[model samples]
Target: MLLALILALGGTMFLQKAFTPKLGLDLAGGTTVTLSPVTQTGQSPPEEILDRAVNIIRDRVNGTGISDAEVAKSGDNIIISIPGVGQSEAIKLVATTAELRFRQVLAMEATQVPQNLSTEAPTPGASPSAQPSSTAKPSSTARPSGRQSATTPSASPTGKALSSALTAPTPGATPEATQTGTGRDQTGQKQNNKGKNGTPTPAPSTPPTAPPNQDPNAGINTQGIDPAVLQQFQKLDCADPKNRGQGVQDDPNKQYAACESDGSAKYVLDVAKVVGTDIDTASAGVRQGTVEWIVQLDFKSKGAGEWSKLTTTAYNAQEPRNKVAVVLDGVVITAPNIISPIPGGRAEITGGFDQVTSTQLADQLKYGALPLKFQRSSIDTVSSTLGSDQLEGGLIAGIIGLGLVVLYSLLYYRGLGLVAVLSLVVASILTYTAVVVLGHNAGFRLSLPHIIGLVVSIGITADSFIVYFERIRDEMKEGRRTLRAAVEVAWVRARRTILIADAVMFIAAIVLYFLAVGGVAGFAFAMGLTTLIDIVVVFLFTKPFIALLARLKFFAKGHPLSGLDAERMSTEPARTTTPQEA
Candidate 1:
């Protein structure tokens, strides 16, 4: 037992650098971010929706592998506290809505644009050379009859433009494509234009406000994409950090405007043709035979049908329309062009994703999205000094309790008190070593409540020692046998009581640990741990040491200070004889 104790201590110290107790936010001083749900109608969301949002947020935070994060809901706000995290990380984890939506790309533009192209603004009469005339007539050859057949391959002019734009790879294009799904148009125009002065010109206005004739309900209607939304997409400056914040959710059935997460591009996206629920699973891995990481998506039965129809429409649409936007939390995570009518509802997002980013995205898709959008209402950093003061106070209280237990044993148990004190020292050493090792490997934190639990355990350990000693002295006082025999016999009887007592505490601790949350759970965990350690010390150290001491003249001969003076005890005849016979 001594050897085991020594090995544990040595191992913990040796691995101290790699494994250390993680402190809670209250102790470590980390970042706290509060998020309030943003409802478009200016009223709080339904309680069920809010509850689901909290759960989704919890899953996302857990997926980040941050063990010390606490996600809770207070009133209508969700509060997230992460220990050992910076403000930026805390905000990133909680603020992201992760509401995955699949929308068609109505238009794409360079985020840096000149002048607010607010559709609400009157037409500007600038130089004919500088301002591309918005009213330029559609060429005769490109414009198709309004009654063009929907079934024929090239029936709809827009469909011909889209199929030609999205399916064929652009000349000189590299294998690595940005997630913003754009390729080339039939007109041989680059989907992305590097505009002058960082402000590029707007995308061609919504195609003549006409729904594609191929599938009258191809559901690919441009008529609903408000010109104002298009203007907002045109004016969007991806470089501005302020523009990156979560915004109001657009009607899922209407065209919406959003910017790419990296601020690389801005886009006008068609309403939701697919959403997170339609997705069955998503995984991230290195592309087969390549080093690049990509996220692969698989859709459910209904989602698959929608995905196929959406891809088919996108494949047959014009430049920006051929692209599909992957929006998360009202922000464009990526937009990829439909290279083909993707069948089977399986697709790959092959942006310039690294393993870490791809894995993160995959996690978000697989875990499902939050039901409500959240905006960061407040963020603050907590200092460790307050935690340090509380810890210091707890330690002082624990030491005082321990000291009292030891002092009482000395005064009452006499020479037996020495045994009790030594046993306690051993238990303490064992408990400390176990906690440090567990903290390092299991992410256990030593909170104030846990400290109190440990203090309580000191008294419990002393009680076991007292029980065994008193039993042995009682046997000797009855003149039944020698000290060694008394020690041996008393242990047999005392162990049963000790086991039952410890068992009750152990069971209670287990129940409390599982049923409680927060700090109370921490206390229960400590209690359970120490209870087991007390058992180990009693069997391996306490019993053996007491048996060994029973052979010493100091105790066997019943010295006054030995706490078992046979002369001072009752010298009654053996219990087999009655008092009248004696």
Candidate 2:
């Protein structure tokens, strides 16, 4: 059963196309990004803040399913090294400020054509309208728009309308309008919006609010906004690259104008009622009995009351006023209408989300907001030539060590050495197959330290065989039992010692793995894994094979070459005939 199970697991490597174990950044080479902190006061960020940022970035990278990523603080910059090439998305995710805020949507305008509206079949033999009809105004009776329910597949008129607008040029948009926008589209497709100098124009900062936080609903009353700010909003085109709002930092105390994440729409949002700090936890999951993905949020105690108040106000408002915009950084990630007041500080944001996107969004919110902003200083691709050379050297050393172990065993144990060699072979096969399978399924990666750990385990495995063999020889030296009887008696004593020793090593490995990070953790993991394999081989193969050999004529009769000759062993003194026995 054990051999068959191992073979079955090995088969999965072919199915997963994971023929080789995943290599770490040191071995495979990868991209490294450096981000310098940007503080409001133009001073260096404190050490504690940088450390916190490193932890958050590390969590975000790991949360995205990338393994063996290295995040560390260097001087005033944060350096992130990810294994493999073309990891642009990971680079972007780790560098994002991820400032999360919840603000009331005062007004909204679609930037792209809605998918449903654009794909509608025109009437046959009917004249096509020159212009698309305007979307109907949302009403109190309307099903909540923008956000999709987790249990349903029904499209949201608001969400579909916004997402559709991103694909093609907006109707009636001029070449000048399109050429002014510079960032990639919501799907990460780069757009051609370079300036006459062939460089991208920086996004302009959001217009400052005239009266910040004075009126809670100031954004809803367009008259209350400064003419210049309102004019900026009116002229802001979501299709324009500079207006997509990628890097703008907006103050939570002020009303701001921004485009949706997908460049589908634009909105004027009121002061933030709740921010990332208010979020106690965030997670992504599917609704019960449903396959649709959703992001759930839990608010802090004070934030719960504020959340309830915000929802109640929106639920009682009209049209776009009833919607709440979830702004990350300066972009509106989503604007969902509140059908009813959501209490208890728990809320769900459901839209067109798959497992991957939902988890990404959840991780961003769960890690909390960074205390300071960061700008990417540079991105460099590391070379693996050094790692390759190191690997070659390490392998050569291991081979030499293994060869010596095998040579010593053969010279000392003679015929029994063959059993030790076969046991080593079996252990190696199990370890290799297990690591490959785990790399495919659990994102395990092999690094230099892991290699060292594996090489060291050879001695650990050989130690087990030596213990059992010596115990058998000790029983033979007593001259009270035959080879067959000694095999069983020796095993009874040897296994107890073997289990205790392995147990101690396994416990140490577990502690080290949890307490350490990066390469140290990898070493501990490799050590623990091989130790377990050693136990399996000793109990299942080594003992059983030796028992079978003990039944053979050459071994049972103690041939001199068999290393079990009676003359080679020192026996107890012969018992003298006692008077009663004689």
Report, for all candidates in order, the number of backbone clashes.
11, 5
The per-model lDDT (C-alpha) reads 0.64, 0.70
Model 2: per-residue Cα lDDT over 1-582, one tens digit each: 568867787788778777777887888888999999998888889999999998899878764232678899989899998887878878888877778888887766555532332222111211111212244212111111233321221223333211111111111111111223443332324456567887543322232344654753344456444455566677777766577555566889988888865555677788899988898988887643356576778889988889889978876766566677878889876675554566667766654467877877788889866667889999999876458788888778878878888898888888888889999989988988888988777667777888888999999999999999999988877745677878899999999999999999999989998777777877888899999999999999999999998878777777778877766666543222222332
TM-score per candidate, in order?
A: 0.54, 0.68
How many collisions between residues are there in candidate 1?
A: 11
Give the TM-score (vs. native) of candidate 2.
0.68
Task: Extract clashing residue pairs from model 2.
Answer: 112-165, 113-165, 181-240, 181-241, 182-241
Candidate with maximal TM-score: 2
Alpha carbon RMSD to native, model 1: 15.0
Deviation from native of the Cα of residue 212 in model 2, angstroms = 27
